[model samples]
Target: MFDSATRRELYEFTRGTEKFYYTSGDAEVELNDVVYEQITISRSEIKNSSDLEKDPLEITFARDSKFAQDCLRSALEENVYVKVIKFQHGQQSILWQGRVVSVKPSGASIVLKSETNFTKLGRAGARLKFQRTCCHDLYGNGCRLNKADWGVQTTIKSVTANAIELRDLSFDDNYFRLGMLQSAFGVSVGIESSAGNTVNIIRRLDSLADQITSDADLLAYQTAVLELDQTIATRDALDENDPNYEQDFADAQALVDQKQEAFNIASESVFFVVAYPGCMKSLTACDRFNNTDNHLGFAYMPEDNPSTTRNA
Candidate 1:
């Protein structure tokens, strides 16, 4: 029921948010999370656009219709703007699409890996424990040991972030690079910068979102962090010498690593990720659950309905 200008504003905000979120393919977004989606009204009212994403708190400070109008007016007057990203559960998973206003850097996208990847990791069974990734063998020798024998990270690096600029992380002059990991439990990361506009914007929105729901904001914040990463890779195999590195990034590595560790932790965590969200939380995790994909070593989880809110 929003008008053209208002709709555009909402669209831009929603698109920007989604663009930021989708770049992080591995980021986890639960259902009914109250995410905003974008919708356009007409062709003529394309006048209102923004060169940049507005601080979400601005909505709170001016949480009235008049303020919203003034804010929209100022936003439209700017140089150019970007469209917002919103997910509508279409036939498939959440789908996102939008346009950019002025030219700006596009961050990485967020995607959910197929259930097969989960199955592969689950196959490692007791072996996922070594605190490493499969790429330990990438270096040819890896100290003459079977590269496969050493520990490797779970996720693989995909795209690079523009905002991230590496500083220095050394070890008694031997020096190790500052590293980030992307996985499941620690999957939600956030953006950061010693200097830049994006990180600042990220901090502000996350801070405000936290006031309302720490968990929700944290998820949104992490989604940004995971997207900044060019791609996921085990820390061991991640190429530090590769010239292009993101200074600001979250360790989704930890999340994947945690899953690798879950092989040993409570079987429930395994069922939750490996099986299904609904099935794991239920007494059925042991049997009734049934995802043909998750059937190995683990039982399948049942399909959840909209009313189901067993776990956050």
Candidate 2:
């Protein structure tokens, strides 16, 4: 027994030492802060350690530098829309630091456990929502949570159930409830509306186009290209004496290039299909079925159909 401790103290202490209290709680301590939890201080030995050395016996300093980088890295990879600068989690070196496991069945507080093998959090589990900024940063982005239980301090990114129409996805620094946040820094953390996206697409398309020279000029240019192609296909002619032949060739090539550019513009957004087989087969079918003239362009059914397609 310790010289300072009495026999009665030792007997009383020995019995209390065997008590096993299991709990889940968070050790609300800041990073780099020094803290400790006594594991198994003996009956009388609890008092004799003060005089042993200058460093003293019992406390351990919790530092973030060792594992902070790792913790942040893990959270960012597993959680989406996570801002690393605002994220924090329990320091493993800290005696009582914990992680919220889930919400209790009652949907009030959360179930938590210490990150260490031999420790537990405060008196009992917390609401988890109490640590919104931390929990949201650590778990919420793509967390598979059930809304029927547990309330997180942070606003969730998304939820299931057709009945629960998502109101919005705006969040703040804490990524907590958007309706109640201190400030939303940088861009609004809101999902773009269907209308907004459509407008953006239209603006992009308009930006890509420029004014035409004139309808008359366009038609004349078209006529020149048609004549050049038709004449070129007719014969292998040496038109060195014809002053317009070179100009016609250039114009026709220019038209082809321009048309190709036009086709490229619609490449991703639209598609067309020329059905009913080859021209000969198509003409035959037209006669056999008594079908009228028709134009098929930019029709869609999710993917390309088995036919030649052209732009409208």
**Using Cα atoms with residue i matched to residue i, what is each candidate's TM-score against the true structure?**
0.16, 0.14
Q: In model 1, where is the ten-residue run with the lowest total lDDT?
A: 270-279
Assess the local accuracy of residue 267 in candidate 1 as a C-alpha lDDT between 0 and 100: 26
Error of 2 at 223 (Å): 0.6
Q: After superposition, how far is residue 150 of candidate 1 from its true place, in Å?
A: 15
Q: Candidate 2 — which residues are off by over 4 angstroms?
A: 1-201, 204-213, 237-312
Model 2: worst 10 consecutive residues (lDDT sum):
6-15
| Best candidate, TM-score | 1
Whole-model lDDT per candidate: 0.25, 0.25
lDDT of each residue in 54-84, candidate 1, tens digit only: 2111111111122222222222222222232
